[model samples]
Each structure stands twice: as C-alpha cells, then as structure tokens.
Target chain A: MDSCQPDEKLDLAGVPCPQNSARTLIKLEGMDSGAMLEVIIDDGEPVKNVPPSVEEEGHRVVEKVRTGDRWKILIRRREE
Target chain B: MGIYLDNAATTRVDPAVASEVERVRRSAEGNASSIHQHGVNAAKHIEKARNIIAGSINAEAEEIVFTSGGTESNNTVLKGVVSLSSNEKKHIVISAIEHPSIIETARWLEEAGISVTYVSVDRDGFVSASDVEKALTAETVLVSIMHANNETGTIEPIKDIGRACTERGVLFHADACQSYTKIPLDVKEQNVDFITLNAHKIHGPKGVGALYVRKGVKIAPLLHGGEQEATLRSGTYNTEGIAGFGKAVEIAHTDDVKKMTELRDWFSKELSENIEGVLLNGPDTQRLSNIINLRIRSVDGNRLAAELDRRAISVGRGSSCSSSKSTPSHVLLALGMDSKEAEESIRISLNKWTRKKELGIVVKNMIEIVTELRMV
Candidate 1:
C-alpha cells in the first residue's frame, strides 16, 4: 500500500459515470495545488471512465485499488 | 443586458409577476399545510393560483398539483404511472422528440423492466397521431407527447393523439410547458388526462410548476410528506412562486401571441432572404409563434452561438436546457437530421418583450457572421 495520505476524500460509489467524473472535477477544483484527493467510486464505468477524465484535466491519478464492488482512486489536484 | 432570444429555455420574469411574488411573501409567513390563520392565508394563495392555472387549461382547481418545475411534473407523471399500474401494464408510448425530462425518465424506467416505445418524427419534427397509435400496445399504460417541442417548436397533434389513447384505454399526458398560455389548450376537448405546465417559460418565477391530472385519474405520488397538493405532491407550498405563476398566466394575452407570430414570420423571411443556405428546422406554420430554429450550412452552431454572445445577441444551440453537452441535439437527430446537420442548427426563441429592432439587429449580425464563418 502507498504510504502517502490524501488531503481529501470523496465517496462517489453508486454514482453513475459523467456525473461521478464531473463531481470529482468539482471537488478537485476546490482543493489546493498538489493536494491529494481519495475518491471511492463504483467499479465498472466509474473505474474505466473517471481516471482518464481526471487525467484529461491535467491532474494526476496516483493509484487505484479494488475494494469489493467499489474502487478507491487517488487523484492529485493539478498545480496552478 | 444583451438581447436574449432563448425564451424557450426560460424568460425574464415580468415585473408584475415579481411584485405579486413579493406581496405573497410579505403577506403570509406560514406553511400552507397547517390549519392556523397564517397557514390558511398561505393556502388561500395556493388555491387561487391553482384555480387560475386549472382554468387556463380547462381543468378543475383540485386537479392541479404544484411541483418544483416542469422536470418534476414530467417525472411525477412517468414514474407515478409505472408505480401504480399493474405488472401487465409495463409499456409506455412517447414521441421521439420529447424533452430530456421525459426521454431520460423513460430510460430510467427501462432499467426497472418498463418497456418504452419512442415513435418517430418526420423531417419537420412533427409527431403524427397515427405513429403514436401504432406504437401503443395492450400493455401500454400511458402515451406521453408534448404539445409543442421546446427545441424545434413543432406542435404535435395532441388532440388526435389524445383521442386515440382514450379510445385504446390508455392515459394521455402532454408536456405543455412550452405551449401553455402561448396557444389554446382545452383538456376536455383534447382528451388529455394529464398535462405538465411550468411558470418560468411564461415570464414567471422559476422553481414553480404544475401537473394537471384529470379528475378521478389515479396515480402514485412521487413525494411523501404533509400531503400538500391533494396528496399528489407533498412539501410546503411555494406560495409566493405559485402566486407569481398565476399572475403570469393571467397577464398572458392572445394579442401577444399574434404579435409574436407576425414578428417570427418577418424575422424568418428576413433571414431566409439574406442568409444563403439557411433552412428552417421545423414546420413553417404549425409551430409555436415564438420559436425559430434554423440550420445554417457550413457553420458550427456552438461557435455561432458563442460568436453571437460576444456580439451581445444571445441565442441557443439546440435546447438551452441541454446546451452543456457537446453532443448534437437528440431532438434534431430524431427529426432525421444527421449529426453534423444537427450541430449546425441554432434555436432563436422570441418573447413578448422582444422588439422588432432587436430581431432586425440579430438578422443583420447573423448574415455577416454566417458569411464570414463560411469563408473559414
């Protein structure tokens, strides 16, 4: 497991794609530069779509790990 | 402020309506559901508003259930019917050009084992009654068709479709949010069992709308609480908003409709004469008087809308309600427009406040912009 602790956490499990990605972006927008945000999202479309969408906004996806039906994704806010 | 031509999405609330809202707020400060004098005062305001709204569509006061807005009213109808109907009655029929509220709700219902048939529209965005009739089945519980489309302003044959649905023993619901007060609507004459009406589109405050359920028509409630709105919709009444909605409806005149129709025609003629390759998106005569949707060849509608915005002339690329999406308009696509063609369309909806000079300015600017953009 990664030793780095996240500064923020958002549990978006069961939230559908596009909206989950949108919420994740909105949350990242409120964070400071280089702040780490841990987001819990549903497995299938969320896992497949969220990280790429986050990356497209110039943010970094630190890691992703499966936890039962949900996946926990670590995203670092883009530096301004 | 810039010239606003996106009235189909929402209009600037009339000053009179705003004053009525303010008056209602200052006069009463109690929940409309309570039995106290303050509550009774608030309830009276709601009842007065309900009566006005119901009378406009030829429905009774008790048949009107106030809701948050058109989206909620449509949702209440679609979901409410499914929840109350028997398992055998699992199917619904709707036109392909329905608002996103209806289309999306139908999609959600599909996930829960409800079947939906989206009847096709013609190239002019016209949904024929026969098409809707053909889509209905023995298990069809409801047939939903909008009175006039928000995107294209193509008026559907709601009366004919309503008659067909009634003959088939299926309930007919019409989303009249775009057509309310702008056109004639007689629920009894049309055989419409349910109608969705909203205030924002008619120069009233936002966040207030109504669903007209014909007397004796039973459906489950979407919300459960103090049983406000005859137990069909529950929550504290938006007394001020409802009063403003009534004022808006009361002030809407047939003369304004005639004025809008004449202005709309003149604007269309000017654009067609000056702008090369511009095509009207819907039927020329059988559409809402206020809406003018045009397809400009060799121009990106989104870019055109943004360009117009910079010039202080606001217009909508497809439905303003769904403008955030990069995808082309689903309504235009349903009307047989290709994806690129749909993307090339922009909607210009006028209001009672819109002046001829403003439309003339828009027309001139559009001609120059389309010409310049085509060169690129």
Candidate 2:
C-alpha cells in the first residue's frame, strides 16, 4: 500500500468522477512505464468508473482500499 | 444540515405534500378506474389533483394527462405527435440544447426517415424564435422547445415561437419540466399545443407528472392500458403520488414561488460577488430565478463539486441528465462555450427550503475551495 514513491503521489483526494480518470490519465502520460500512481477519491461512482477506464487505457489498478468515505486507489503504468 | 443546491435535479418533498401522500397511501385506496366506494374516493382525489395542477399552469383539467415523469412525458409528446401526423408532414424542428429525451427522441425520428432540423442557441443559450421561423417548412409537423433549460436556466422565447408555429400551422410543444412550478406558465399565453412538467422538480413525489395537451389536439398514445388519462397515457394512476403532486402544486402556487425566487436571486448575487472568475451561464434578465449556473475559470467543476460536497454543500456539475456521461456539457457546447469553460460550469438551484444562513455557508465554502484549488 505504501509502495508509491513520495514524489510520485497523484492525490485526487477530493475530486469527482471522470475528472479523476482524466487527471489519472494525464499523470500516467508523464510517468515512465511501471511507475505507480496513488489516487485518493470519494467512494461513489468513481469507485466504479475509474479502475475500468484506467485499465482500458493500458494501466493496472493494483490496490483499491476503502477508508470511510475516501478510497485509496493505486495504478501502475504499463509498458507500451 | 447539508445544503441542497441540486434542486434542478429533484427537490425534497414538502412536509405537507408528504403528509397528504401518506394519508392517501394508508387508506389502501382502490383503483381510480374501479367502481367500488374506495375507488370513487380515489377517483375524486385524483380529479381534485388534476384540477389543482391544471389551475397552477392555467390549463383545463382535461388537458392534464398524468405520466410517470418528465422523460416519459417528453417521449409521449415527441413520439405521439410524429406518429399521429401523415408521412407527408414528416419534418420536425427541435432545439439543439433540448433535454436528452427530446434530442434522443428526435434522433429516433430521424432514423425513421423523418427530417429533423436542430435549431441552434445563442451564446447565452437562448434559442432564437426567428431561427425557428426560418426552419419551418410546409411539411413541418411540430416544433419542440424547452420552456427553461435544466442546466443553464435559460428561458426560451416560447411565446414568440408559438406564434410562429401558429401562423405556419405547425404544432408546438414546450418541455416545462424545470420551469413549471418556479415560473409563471400559461398555456394560452404561450399558445403551445403541448406542455410537459414533472412533479419531482416542485417538492412533489417522484414517479408522477402531467403532460398538457391542448383540447382538440390529436396525438397517438404512448401506452395503452385501461384507457386512462383520456387514452393518451394509460396506467393505474399513482393515487398517492398524484395527491402529493397536487398538494405541492397548490403550495407552490400559493407560497413557495415568491419566497424561493427571492432566495435564489439573493444566493446568486452573493456567490457571484464572493467568487472571482464566476460567469453566469444564461441571460440575466430572462432566466428562471430558482437556478444559477456559474462557471469558475480554471477550477474543474467536477473537482469543485467534490470539494463542496466534502464541505456538506451539495451542488451539481452539468445537468443531472448528463451527469453520468464523461463528456463536457452538450448544452454549454451548443451555447458556444468551449469545452474547458463547459467543464468549469456548476449549477446551483434553490428551493423554498434553502435558507440565507445555509447559502452563506455555501458561498463561503465555495469561495475558499475554488481559491485554494486555483492556487494548486
């Protein structure tokens, strides 16, 4: 759960759906293959929409944990 | 107490309306179509409700045909009108910014070999009546325009468009789902053949609404069962929901309209002054008073909505109709706003229950959040 590097954090802590996916996409584009991204979001539609959208974009969602109303999602950038 | 700024999506049922609904439900009311004593009572209640809803919109009770909700009402009008018309009169005109129900229904009509012209809106989201005039051909059967936009609160010039349709001998239908209870609507004044409104927008129970069909106008029915609602709409009437809807309309007509409008305007002025880069979406003078659409530059509306929700202030991003879709608002795009600007748009709608203190908190929290997010 703590595998992500401190400088590699992508905090989407208070963002909504689609935007979370969008920001995750932008961050993934700038990162090297196999780099990890830590995403924090509210648990609702995003919990359902984000992982699939990320996977479809060729990234791997490694861990998804629900802590109260917030969700911590980890995505690993895939090799092209 | 969580602030509810999503009134455009749906409103909490008023206590009075809820009580009326409960009373009807607890009675185990017989079917309005049945001939029993309980059925007679239920039928009487439904008739009273029909009258109340009709009087609120300045239409006859017979013109009000109850439906499940706005989507069904819109579908009924668009499909019903086209189905009733001859193949020669296959042309239909609709605004580009109409609700998905209308736009999608028009799309279906297009697929069915009907000619459809989508009239564009101005920068402020107002559809020009002259554009409708220019689009009308002798083969045009109907013109469907919304009375007020759900996202931007822009009120169209329905009366002028109605007059044009009248002169051209074309049927006119206006979707008044968002504006019916908040604004004054008169079928005669607008001269529209059909008007659609939903109960849930006005603090009434969900699952119930009415479509106003002008007397003597012929249209095909969307559903067939028990020959209910003059055979235009057919289903076992939702007695309790209709009762709540009637009570809500009565309350709206007598009490909430003036108070909510005042609260809406006050909230808009305060929010605009407090938040920098806030641009109003629709016309200042012509929009509905209960809705305020503002674009906060550089702050993603989805993020802003999440932050505001975290602070217990519940506003919405884009129209509730398009909330699940990932794209920016089509209505804003039609109004000539760039995609980025559309993504920054948030809709705040007020109701009678919205208080000044709550709005103050909302404005304060929104200003702080947007400021902080912009810096990031």
**Most TM-score-accurate candidate:** 1
Residue pairs clashing in model 2 are: none
Give the Å shift of residue A66 in candidate 1.
70
lDDT of 2 by residue, A1-80 (tens): 53655227766655544445655665677788888888887788778877887887788888898999888888898897
**Pick by lDDT: which candidate is best?**
1
Q: Name the lDDT value of residue B167 in candidate 1.
A: 96
* Candidate 2 accuracy as lDDT: 0.85
Quote the lDDT for B350 in model 2.
86
**How accurately is candidate 1 docked according to DockQ?**
0.01
- Please give me the DockQ of candidate 2 compared with the native complex: 0.01
Which 10 successive residues of model 1 chain B have the least lDDT summed?
Answer: B32-41
| Candidate 1 global TM-score | 0.82
Error of 1 at B186 (Å): 0.6
Candidate 2 lDDT over B1-376, as tens digits, reads 6888999999999999999999999883687665444564566567778778888878976688989999999999889989989857599999999999999999998999999999999999999899999999988999999999999889999999999999999999999999987778899998899999899999999999889999899999999977777677778889999989999888885367677767778877887788878888888878887788899889999999999988888887898978878799999999899899999999999887778888888888988998899999
